[model samples]
Target: MPKKWFQNWFNSPYYHILYQQRNNAEAEFFIDNLCEYLKPSAEANLLDIACGRGRHSIYLNKKGYDITGIDLSIASIQYAKQFENSHLHFYVHDMRYLFYVNYFDIALNLFTSFGYFDTDYEHVKALKNFQKALKPDGLLVLDYFNSNKVLNMLCPQMIKTVSGVDFNIHKKIENDKIIKTIEFEDQNKPYIFKEEVKAFSMGDFKLFFEQSGFEISHCFGNYNLEEFDPANSDRLIFICKKAL
Candidate 1:
């Protein structure tokens, strides 16, 4: 069987290099707003599922929470582990499997991390894993793209030069998935990568959360926690709770 696009693209060094300039301020602001809105206890135990490089986990730890960050990429975990302390931990683990049962006050699947699977069952399985990892009534914050808005404003192609590397990117929606193809060169070698994410709508997420034994507590449009408008918002942020 061929390797999954995510496994190949995400584990590549060029992936990090291409996205190295992602907006950190916006991410930090979102984290701050989320924490303020949720108001977990000062010492609450948190889990960051699919936590690439542990940036959000480290920030949460700095805010006095005990955080465990897990990702499928071994390289990412190894790099993230360098920031580990008594209150923060990093592990290489797949999201479809439960890491701990009834163990966390909060579980976060941020930055559109939940929809890479090829099948609906796989997506549901990952959600169940997240639900099982949380205590009864524990919170889950799932940050994903607003598929409707994204499709309306999709940019088909672009070229970016970052740190002396030129990246050519193409995007399209096909078979209900948003596909991004990236091509670049490094050290005189040509490389290509593809990312495919399901264009899941709000109704789809509602059904998934219900089937996974979670109750949607809140939904937001953007980092500032604005009301969600399917046609206008840039984000689909759901705050759910494990069913009691």
Candidate 2:
């Protein structure tokens, strides 16, 4: 059977090449603010879900936390392992399955990592896994795009050239989901990829979390930790705590 879209696309070398500009600075800022706000113990166990290249995991580990990063892309995990130390680790994992039970003090699903599943149940299962992996008082920081603002700012088509590869990107909203079709050519070989993310609103997320044993403690609009504005915010950052 063919691999899933994310498995194939995210594992490809071109994926990293196209998104190479995502670096540590912005992530560091977010992490710094998040850590300050949550104030987890200095030796808290942190889990970074769908941790592409373990960037956030490595950063938190350097801040004296024990961090574990997991992603579905094996290649990304291998590269991320190069930065591992006694307090940092990376593994290839799927978010819908359970890993460590009641093991982490904090679980992070950053950079809009959720909402890739085709079925709504799958997304819930992923959140259940996140909840199951955390301790009783564990915190979950989910950084996702503001669906309302994104829908308002949707672009139909665009083109980007990265490392001499011209990527033709087209986006559309269908069936309550935002889909991006990516086509590119490299060295005379053609490539095609697709990314489909559910445009989940805050209400939708609240429902999901409530059903998955979590309660929303805070909602921020962006990396600066500002208040959320449904009409204008660029991102929807949710801070959730495991419910009793």
Candidate 3:
């Protein structure tokens, strides 16, 4: 059987090249804002799920928190491991599997990382795993795109040039999922990859959270931590706690 779209694309070197413009400044800004809002304890244990290259984990560890970064991409994990210390670690992990049980003080699934699976069952399973990874009353910070706004302002096609490579991109909504197709050539070879994410709304997440034993304590619209506006916000940021 062939590999899953994420398993193939995310593990490819081209994936890093295509998204190389995702700067550390943006990540730091968001994480700083988040820490300001959350005000977690200095000894807090954080689980950064889908932590690409340990950017957030490194920053959090620098801020006096114990952090573990996990991602399915082996290359990304290897790169992240170079930064590990006593309080910071990186591991290759799948979100759908349980990594720890009631261990972390905080769990984060950031950067629209929660909606790639083919079935709702798989998505819920991942959420359950996240729930299991946290302590009683632990916080889960989930950041996802505002699907409604994305669809309303959908751009059908575009071209992005990075590292002297031109990536042709197409996007569409089908079967309640947003599909992004990327095509590019490198070293005289062409490649195509697809990313399919469920267009989950607030209502959808409420159900997912309920099933996973979490309750949303706050919902922000963006990195600034403003109130959520379904039709206007660029991001859907949820601060949840394990349900009693």
- Candidate 1 TM-score to native: 0.97
Off by over 4 Å in 2: none
Residue 188: error of model 1 in Å? 1.8
CA lDDT scores, all candidates in order = 0.92, 0.93, 0.93
Off by over 4 Å in 1: none
Candidate 2: clashing pairs of residues:
none
Quality of model 3 by C-alpha lDDT: 0.93
At residue 59, candidate 3 shows an lDDT of 89
As a whole number from 0 to 100, the lDDT of residue 27 in candidate 3 is 87
- Cα lDDT tens digits for candidate 2, 1-244: 8787899989999888888888789999999999889998987999999999988998898889999999999999999999998889999999989999999999999999989988889988999999999999999999999999999999999999988889999999999989999999888989999898999999999999998999999999999999999999999999999999
TM-score, prediction 2: 0.98
Tens digits of per-residue lDDT, candidate 3, 118-199, equal 9999999999999999999799999999998999999999999998999999999999999999998888999999999999
